[model samples]
Target: AEKGTDRSTLMDILWDVQRRKRYISEDDIGKIGQAFNMSKTELEGVITFYHFFSTTNRGKYTIYLNDSIVANQSGRKAIQRAFEEALGIKLGHVTPDNMFGLYRTPCIGLSDQEPSCLINFKPFTNLTRDRVFEIVTELKSGKRPSELCDIPKSIIHYTPAEERTVFFKPYRQFSSLSILNTYSPEEIIDLVKKSKLTGRGGAFFPTGLKWEFCRNNPSEIKYIICNADEGEPGTFKDRVLMEEHPELMIEGMIFAAYAVGASEGAIYLRAEYMYLRDRLEELLSKYRSQGYLGKGIKAKTPFDFDVYIHMGAGAYVCGEETALIHSMEGKRGEPGTREFFPVEKGFNDRPTIVNNVETLCAVPRILEMGISKYLSLGTKATPGTKLFSVSGDCSKPGMYEIEWGMKLRDFLDLIGAEDPCFILFNGFAGECLSEADFDREISGENLLAEHMQFRFKDPLEYARKMGGIGLRSGGSFMVFNKQRDLLKILKNVADFFVAESCGICVPCRTGNFLLNKKIDKLILGHAEQQDLDEIKEWSNIIKITSRCGLGKMSSTALNHAMLKFPEVFEKRISANTDFNKSFSLEGATADYDRIINEMTLDYD
Candidate 1:
């Protein structure tokens, strides 16, 4: 009962119920719904929207194995089989003893260390078949997964000395806060503007501009939401920032609160990072004790601000600011059509400023280091260093602090990319580039230009007219060597979008499903040139009509792949155009047969 029954606290209360019971039973849900004044249907919708929350029993120790493309490339199938063998249960089933449940989940922000799983929400990385057996054995012997798994360290590489690094530098406690006392809200915004910092969370919106807009809003109660929902597959840089340098992010949020006159703030952490919740709460408590947070922080200013940690169950669409606010309000995590921006109407109809983990973490460092020094780090158009989660076909697959304007070729060399042929600049929702585009510079200038050009015309035509691909990344740099099957990778990416789509709009829901089917056709050598044309046509429809970024960019990697490597698809296309010849009757009836057999067995 410590957790209030208010609608706002529904997520927190549900998390408690899930933890205590291992699943939210119907009786528990009824009680929660009555207390929160919600309907059973509404509560069930909320529960089913998130990947982590479930209504059925998930056994005492649940294992969510990562099934991302990178995980498969790193022998995830073998490790999965080992876990099944050790546990004596099939995937997606609980053991007869109910001591273990195995399930497959999307990427948990651990691409660098593939073949990973969250056993009771604690990450166990770089799993081999032998390691899987040992882990199951340990669990059977009453060993806690937490006791066996150490906190995963940030595998940052190809960076300069710690002193030179922006985030990893030695931090003086409350240094930025002390500086905040000297400046007005206007001055703080101006400093950020002069520094030329953009949102590092893929949108690339001007940081200072966003703050100014929020500060200008007339709402008395404003909010500062640090978007810690780093659900983008192949991206874990935010995870490192939150784990190692959460203080910086907290201080940054305090700075934002001071600027925008926000009394309360929250860190909407993703469910995958549930392990870090306790440590973060402890840090917040410590800050309160030391006067770095709470009313009249440090007793030198009029600011009255405090921040809380809000846990996300698991919805990739919640990474969008609108969907995030809806989730925070104890509603289904669905994106709303933006009649007004978040800065105008957000988080219970109050003015809100939503910044990503990297954007906020940089705020304190920018103030502490001064504008000139921060601006000197990267190109003039896009100043400051960005943390990239580098993985796939690299000798060093981890985090790297790269400045803007670095050539794609240079970055590949720095990361020791092994015969890199294709690269996914961001996550699946971002662009794809081939070796021919290596000379392009990774900067905001090209990205902004590309955005403007792609808004009205075809991206492939624009690329052809410009003579090459433009480079822009949201800090995910996944390199694929020649040995990697591009079609298989595309199929995995298609599957991720299908599973993660929130299904609020018809375009996103149906488009992703149809796109996945088309990708399967291509992979199976049943796709003809007409199928390729239909893929492009469907991709355009999804991009143009989709309500949110998820549907809009769901086909981005597929579109880019077809453009960059036409030969890959061309080779797979069958000469026969007859749809009847390609159709498989047995394959279509496989699910029907399985369901009938299961029903017969239950009756017997």
Candidate 2:
């Protein structure tokens, strides 16, 4: 190997890795070393810096169990216990027979999804322990499993691109190494370098890149946090993952902790996830008992790590990473400026890495599949599969694991969107899509490469111009049927933004109140152009000057809707409509009086 340079791709090295020991060769190490102009040991150092690489052969049939509140509340633990009892194996251990390996994943936030399992990489929802046992028994007996339960079929396949494009589906090569085994940090980082999986949370940051940042930071104590609080109005993917495969998530957490040199981690679930909290506690106890956690994890491994759960009081702002960290510190949830990146300053003023449930869960897979395999799956920028919480007007709305480059029409077809409806990315509680402007590819990174297409002129134009919402912001898709009232929806949304203003920013608090009143006047058929201008002005000001992304983006929800569907607002304020429906000026006085009286105390 020359010190100056060499011409070899990562794929060449990865192939060498795949060719060794009936699996891949460790010689892939020297290939990468030669390419990067470094020694093999240096290449190994970089590989061990992250949590997405694997060094061992794993079982053919891999079982990823999600243990979170949504599933636990729906009774996932009992199902897990049943699976363990039936298999006569522990939760996180693979069987000696290599028939199966079970690991828990943190909440993927598919709350409506019943207890679930990932069978041979395909998600099987609405499951129980008996159901899992039946599937396992059938697979073991070499018998095609019976038409067991009503697990809904989804067209969303989440394999690497080569696998997706390979038409001649040879019988799956059931290799023990195909299943992800224990991974070292360097291996995880190398795998990530290969897969190119970005975070599944709203921001869509590169998972590998983030690990690199935290790893390189000169901090004594780095921290990684898993944000499981699924409080977005129509988003619930995280909750589902927690309930169905808690340990898979735990594995992801452990992987992250190892990658970033973090000793402690926390899963922040919303207060509504009480069941998930309890289940996680039980799983943690099991892992600790097995010595998989605490001071020394992985057979006296020098790396030290532990995970804990923190329940949030159900504030939407807590979804923001900064706010969640603050709340985890026992303070009111509110976001601060992103002046210093969390990679530099986080938990206890240490460098921190915060990722959502789905992002981390993808770690084990990326490690097993390799970076190039992961990169081949989705769009160029948005590589790897994504978990989506589909709610609202669509038929069979639930959590889906889809490729990033998939089309909206394709998604609609997959979910049976034969009827016309509005598409809302993020949440119905977030933004509403009237035209297909948002109908482009659903990968945030890819979309950013094309430049963010935010402002829209009209609904029809929007559809034509919309490339796609970037995947970084937790690639969520919500559909609203025509039966929904657009104006009424916007009004409700505005009211919510006003109510949840936190009273920290004066412009947000007062301006939102005025905007609410302005909407009321418009709805009451007493509005003017001047009023509309004022509402827009105030909303714009608040949008520009808010303290956090929440306050800043809050106005966009309504403003976007107004631009896309102004007719809905105008039509709702007809002279024939009931004006009283718009406001309750008189009732407000009585409500305030009641509040004042309730706060009053008698001398007696």
Candidate 3:
């Protein structure tokens, strides 16, 4: 805690080392361990647990190509092959020239413009074979990557508050940290509940209740954690909020700390947003300089709360609250059993409340304009507006904030999703609703459950329907047109869960692996009727027995895709019934076979 800040940052040290030296080394690890008073093995454990922390300086420019579903459908396979052939180096390897390191990442949040890559954390989207070569030529010619960077203006198209609230109102305005002195902590909690605010981080937990729990938990210390590790694929709204309106969020955190009796607050941002670190640090220092932060903020109340940002090192599972707590404490970012929630025990075993980035961003608006005005904006069940990251086959593929309960069809038309046939709601871990559900409203209420409730008068009779998929999103919705392959898309979704699973529980570890294998068999047309039954069995087992939310939702995309698009698999089975591989193999090996034959002429 030296530097007037909580410096328990393993991820930060690793990131600093990687940026400075291109990679981390064992000697560097020893020095870091000694400086931080940590075990050397523990330091290495943290590095290996994350995918972004590498140990070798393989190349000067690290190229992370997007291998997500959106990219693949947009001809990422051909683009990857083109890069391999042009560079003369296979993926996961650096060329002898030490120019580039090719790696595959899940998603860099640009599902709108697919076949994308991040050269040293800068995004380059909508890549063609020619464009890849052209960019490579520039990189090789000592050109900066930022020269080719495509920075879009206002990724969030509009602010919901408009001219009514101060969120997106004016530039560098004074945040209402002074307003916290006007209300007691209990009254503040009542205002949040009156606003009917809930967590926007997928779980839909009540934000007010969460704060109330930690506030009443009687501890020597408490913490407020804004979960900004927006690792969900196709989600980039948080990045825009964090980069553009960070002060609004910081003000929210300070208000939250005052309400919950927390001395410290932290914002855990993902490592992919590493470029914004210096700007955020400078903002914090500026606030501290003005007496809005550090001891006795505004000198009105004893709310000595300051916020810090923690970087997550490429683990999607850390989006879960408990797993995030573990990462912040310099341990493996894995979820623990949920007997005691974070409101009871979290972040150094202190009572803590974890709010999502959007949730925090929305807080300042509610506090300023009063809770009634916020509640009047959206549906009865879910009040206020929410942000959505719309991409995939959309004319305007960017962020938008709208009042909830809008028709799905109207949303598609507004965003210009031409010929939209499918909806991948809330990334791979969320639902896959079909075109038939276009008329459905995007609200907090689950439409399938509502349908079941109204259709069947009896609660027991509701179980008889084979069921349909409903969208319950945490503000991520991706649309794919009819030209995309449904089965292959599901396979990509399955592969993401398989790659991202924490493997802490058996159901997530083994179940997601088997689920992916079944998808592979279905894609290859080698699956039997028995395989379908086995998939159902495994999916149910994983959903029921998984220890954490990630494991429980691991098979969600597959299950929903199968329900909505069963014909994709059924047609593939008939096409592969009389599979012939001889001609295909021969066609692929034509040129290579002739060269090999010439080399072995004496044997021939």
Compose the digit string of candidate 3's lDDT tens values, residues 529-602.
67778888899999878877677777887887777888876776666666553346778889899989888995
User: Judged by lDDT against the true structure, how good is candidate 1?
Assistant: 0.84
TM-score to true structure, per model: 0.92, 0.63, 0.86
How does candidate 3 fare on TM-score? Answer: 0.86
Q: What is the lDDT of residue 577 in candidate 3?
A: 64
lDDT of 1 at 352: 92
Off by over 4 Å in 1: 158-164, 298-301, 447-449, 452-472, 575-604
- Model 3, residue 2: distance off in Å is 9.1
How displaced is residue 327 in candidate 1, in Å? 0.8
- Candidate lDDT scores, in order, read 0.84, 0.60, 0.76
lDDT of 1 by residue, 497-518 (tens): 9999999888889988998998
- Candidate 2, residues 439-486: lDDT per residue as tens digits? 666665433444333333442233222211122255456666677655
Question: Candidate 3 vs. truth: CA RMSD?
Answer: 8.0
Model 1 pairs whose backbones collide? none
Give the residue spans of candidate 2 off by over 4 A: 1-187, 299-301, 428-430, 445-472, 572-604
